[model samples]
Target: MKITEQEVHSVAEIARLELTQEEGQKITHALQVILEQTEALKRLEISKVKPTVYVLPLQNVFSEDQLDKCLTQEQALGNAPEVEKGCFKVPRII
Candidate 1:
């Protein structure tokens, strides 16, 4: 899992990245540590633990629907830039 500067440079060449020599060495070491950590995770024992879908309990706390007063046709269409035959006239797409 240990990545070297030559491997990082090869990957950078494939990805079209122009990393400096110092940056390439830094990236190689960082990538090596990440792979080592992932490898270490494989050694953990969790066979007796049950898998969980949600981390926290979820519940609906919304209020019930209620009726309300509505606006008239003239009030709703008052802000239209163009109207024809009691309806808004929009530009045709096709």
Candidate 2:
């Protein structure tokens, strides 16, 4: 697939980038090469291959949940910069 310099320029506009004519030409050629490689991949035979979320055979690694001692409310707000009504107070974010 051939990408045009105009298309590259449009992308630059969307990304708020300022590019020289040389940079636009380079980006256009690079995008064309990348698209061609993907197009070539469409001809590969992979009907029997299974799709995977990752390359590895991943398994759940989480440990079983167990009851544990809990901290008091004061402990949680101990190192807070500001406290109001026994709770941490942070600047309102509008």
Tens-digit lDDT track for model 2 on 23-53?
Answer: 9988888889899989987798989888877
Off by over 4 Å in 1: 45-94
For all candidates in order, the CA lDDT equals 0.88, 0.89
Tens digits of lDDT, candidate 1, 51-74: 878777776768769878788878
Q: Which pairs clash in model 1?
A: none
TM-score of 2: 0.48
Using all chains and alpha carbons, the TM-scores for the candidates as numbered come to 0.45, 0.48
Each prediction's RMSD over C-alphas, in Å, is 11.4, 7.3
Off by over 4 Å in 2: 48-94
